[model samples]
Target: MDRLIEAIEDKQNPSVVGLDPTPALVPVQVMDAYHIEADEYVEDDDDNLAATGAAAAYFEYNRAIIDAVADIVPAVKPQIAMYEALGPAGVDCYTMTCQYAREQGLYVIGDVKRGDIGSTAAAYAKHLSGFDGADVWHEDAITINPYLGSDGIEPFTAAAGETDRDLFILVRTSNPSSAQIQELELADGARVYEHVADLVEQWGADTIGRFGYARTGAVVGATHPEEGAALRARMPHTFFLVPGYGAQGGTAQSVAGMFDRDGSGAIVNSSRGIIGAWRDDPRYSETLEAQTALDLVAANARAAAEDMRDQLRVALA
Candidate 1:
């Protein structure tokens, strides 16, 4: 787990590329190359053949993105909905994607965000912890929803203890609707999320890695920069996963406060803004394969990440 944390820290740019592949959103030429049919794509009620095709398409897209940006970024977060909707074949692709990412020296954070109780949560831990099976395991880390509070989180914590893995508790999400519940003022005047943040810090305290940061982390949305900064201050030793940076309209400057003076303790995630940029990019208009659309998007991502990192460096200086 320490090695996982250290890998991101060493990169200086703590940007995690989200591999969110939407069949309709991918470039037309790319889709045409695969000859992917709309009927074969993921639907609310996809049969096995449709599901298998969708999963295969997702696997190919993820592989291409990973090959392009793995060296530049710290980690890749594969959204579970996109994969799970495709069913078992999708699960197989998910497992392969994790394996491929590890081979490329990038951490795989399964964006499962699973929340349950007792045995079910433990089963999810086994499916995700990377220690259960040598082939299908994703060892880096998995996202956990803390809506059920300590009871929901305890099982993940216990699983981390067994596998030497880690968990990122969703304290503050980037979604706009999140404020309705997360910002509810508690009896003690602290917001509901603040209480969640406090618990995250405490749970992470016992799991501090070799570095000053702890393995337990909180998912603080970049949309709420001030609140994100407040959480950072409260849990100085905890790691942060800052989403909503790119497509969600969060600027690089807005997310600067989430990191330490050394540009550590946080990783900013962007999905549609990077991978989907090619569709709207003027430079990508000239030639799809000949030009570097993916490369350009990846470069821009690296630049955005580094720019945010440099802002912290300048602030500290």
Candidate 2:
């Protein structure tokens, strides 16, 4: 966690761009270039051609975003689903994105949310976190699901210890319907999330990092300010991957409590709000929504990152 905290302090920013690119958000020019670049790999297979082209598009868009904001932000969390949406080639895009981000000296939090038991869990624990092998998909950290209980949680923590990496356990998510499951009351008088938070604390107890926080952090959504604050008190030693900002309606004021008073324990994430800003934000209104100039596309992303940094700075101040 010292590595992660160092990046945060170096950039003076606590948020990471979620490189969750979609065709709708990507400029058509980039897509056309992708298809052309895929020509070498296409040969005779139509399906492979389409997948290759789409994968190329995603990779290029993600690379541009990375190049744009790498210096200002500590990391990039490429929501695996975005790449997984494209099938095998999509997975290739996911791994390739990881490789490129690391090359740029940025950290990565794989938004996989994987959870299982026994050997299956152990396998995921080995492959997902830590960049020990040549496989580029190895991430700096990954989000994990705690539904299967401690058995599911221990494997990832073990994996985290093997490297200076981490795992963000899903305690309370940001979605509107998260409560239906995460907020259920247990017989012990603790809410479901509170129970999960306690599990996160227990799991990370042996692995506190150089930053005085644990490698096993919690995914407590900033959307629930009160709940986020309470979880902050409960898991003082855990870091937080606070999502639901920007596109999901989370604000600086809402997520302020997700951090320690020192403002070093959380990393906020803004996905569509930053990646799709060429379309969604008024500041970039004049830019063409389709086939944007690559430089302008990246420039806008950098601006959005700076703006997010400022917002957090104001809140923390």
Candidate 3:
């Protein structure tokens, strides 16, 4: 658990790459390299492409992104929906991506957002907490939905404690629809999410690492800057996994409040904005050469990431 905190502290910048693979957005070279028709593959459930080229494309795209940003960001988060849509083949790629990310010395956050009953939840925890077996297990932290309360969270909490892994509970999510529920005020005057935050903070207390931050964390969106800041202040020792940056339109300045005084308490995540930027951003693509296409696209993406980090520094300073 201390290793998790130390890894975050060492990076200084709390930016995380959200890997949500959309086959249409992958570079042609990557597509050609593996003879993968990702767009067609994702659409056809019974297509043989699922087991053949689709799985290969999944690993290739992720490997490319990891190579590009591994040096810059603290972690990579694979949105489970993208991988799970492919079924077991996608799960194999997810497993490969996790292993590759670990080898690159970056943390992996399984953005599965799973919430279930106690017995079933424990099964998920076992598979995801890297306790089932090293091959198919996820060694890093995962996101959990607390809508079911302690019954859903208890199994995850237990697994995290045993494995020294971490869980980032969804307190105030970034999606627009979240306001309908999370913002509802209780008779006690606390918003529903506020109470969730308090509970998450309490759950993480025993999991605190030596660096003064806990393995228990929260996924607060960068879209709600003020709320994110207020939550940061409320849970000073908790790690924050922030989404909604880049493609979701969250500016670095808007999310700057997530950082502590030293600028190391939270991580901002960007998925389509970083990986799929080449589709619209010509500064990256518009290349004819295969190698050049990969390099230019990767370069532009890295530059955008660096610019975001610089803005965060300015805002924090």
- Residue-pair clashes per candidate: 0, 1, 1
TM-score for each predicted model, relative to the true structure: 0.85, 0.94, 0.89
Worst 10 residues of 3 by lDDT: 33-42
Across 105-157, the per-residue lDDT of candidate 1 in tens digits comes to 99888888988876778777775554436535664788999876677677788
Superior by lDDT: candidate 2 or candidate 3: 2
Clashing pairs in 3: 14-267
What is candidate 2's lDDT per residue for 260-312, written digit by digit as tens?
Answer: 98988999999988888766545443344424555566878888899999999
RMSD of each: 3.8, 2.3, 3.3
Which parts of model 1 have CA positions greater than 4 angstroms off? Answer: 32-47, 130-132, 283-317
Cα error, candidate 2, residue 297 (Å): 1.7
lDDT of 3 by residue, 180-274 (tens): 99999999999999999999898878777876778778999988999999999999778898999977778888888888887777878888777
How accurate locally is residue 207 in candidate 2, as Cα lDDT from 0 to 100?
A: 90
Q: Which candidate is the best by TM-score?
A: 2
> Which candidate would rank higher by lDDT, 1 or 3?
3
lDDT of 1: 0.75
Off by over 4 Å in 3: 36-46, 131-135, 280-292
